[model samples]
Target: MSPSVTDHVVGRALSWADIPRLVELEGRLFADDAWSAPTWWAELAARPRRDYVALESDGELVGYAGLDLAGEVADVMTIAVAPEAQGRGLGGELLALMASRAREAGAAYLLLEVRDDNAGAKALYARAGFEVVTVRRRYYQPGDVDALVMRLRLRDERDGVGDTNG
Candidate 1:
């Protein structure tokens, strides 16, 4: 098994200083669908409603994730791991961080959308206990790729469904 991100990386709140690096990584990782620098700035400007985390190894940023908390629901804005840092469980750790943050904010559900072509990411989300709630046909432009809307219930105990507090 690969080393877990927590074994060697330090995680902290993401700051303005990370925008350039994040944009670069987004360009590399998401290619045609990468978020622009201005979009990132807007996301940061949203303040307490939007929360983000950055992970560093040896003082180099390796991964980051963001969440948008809105009442009983929280949406995952994005999650990215540098190419060199992939397969180290950093993605899962980042995803867990988002989920935990959402739950802490009293969110009952967490939602995210991933391109259907991204098998690895879909697998990661599935392993993290997310289920496909819907599919947006041709949601990704240019290539016309489909997007899978996945959701995880953060607080389902009242309906007799097991809580995901673990």
Candidate 2:
């Protein structure tokens, strides 16, 4: 990813003061299945290994995402873009940022579990260099859908090639 595109928006650790608006975006994008306010707070505050970021456009938050880094492994926890901002490459941008953070933290691999039904999210991760590693049965609630576990190696490096991570 190029820094030029990153300049259009800014990402920073989520602040407790931004919780209300963050909840609003999460509710709108994830419906009732979104993680609770307390969860976000803990990830942003209590968890030293977790990295939570909010993507803002024009001074208003349009998306949010977070990753949990464990040693040389990182797991993408949540990523949601406002419906209005969908299809603008924001998801990819957010993933790139998270992956970059993962690499900078010395992670050798990144993992994510996506709903089997969410092809859009799966595609984004694939394009970012992730591959399906396994599946979890009846992972999501309200509809017993399975979850696809995907993995991407961050150790691959080739000069002049665009590494998926921003």
Where is model 1 poorest over a 10-residue stretch in terms of lDDT?
1-10
> For residues 33-61, could you state the per-residue lDDT of candidate 1 as single tens digits?
89899998899999799998898977888
Give candidate 1's whole-model lDDT: 0.86
Single out the weakest 10-residue window by summed lDDT for candidate 2.
1-10
- Give every collision pair in model 2: none
- TM-score, candidate number 1: 0.91
Model 2 lDDT at residue 165: 48
lDDT of 2 by residue, 80-163 (tens): 888877787888888988888888888888899999888889889888889999999998887998999999877666532335
Q: What is the TM-score of each candidate against the true structure?
A: 0.91, 0.87
For each candidate in the order shown, give its overall lDDT on alpha carbons: 0.86, 0.81
lDDT: which candidate is best?
Answer: 1
Superposed model 2: Cα runs more than 4 Å off? 1-7, 157-163
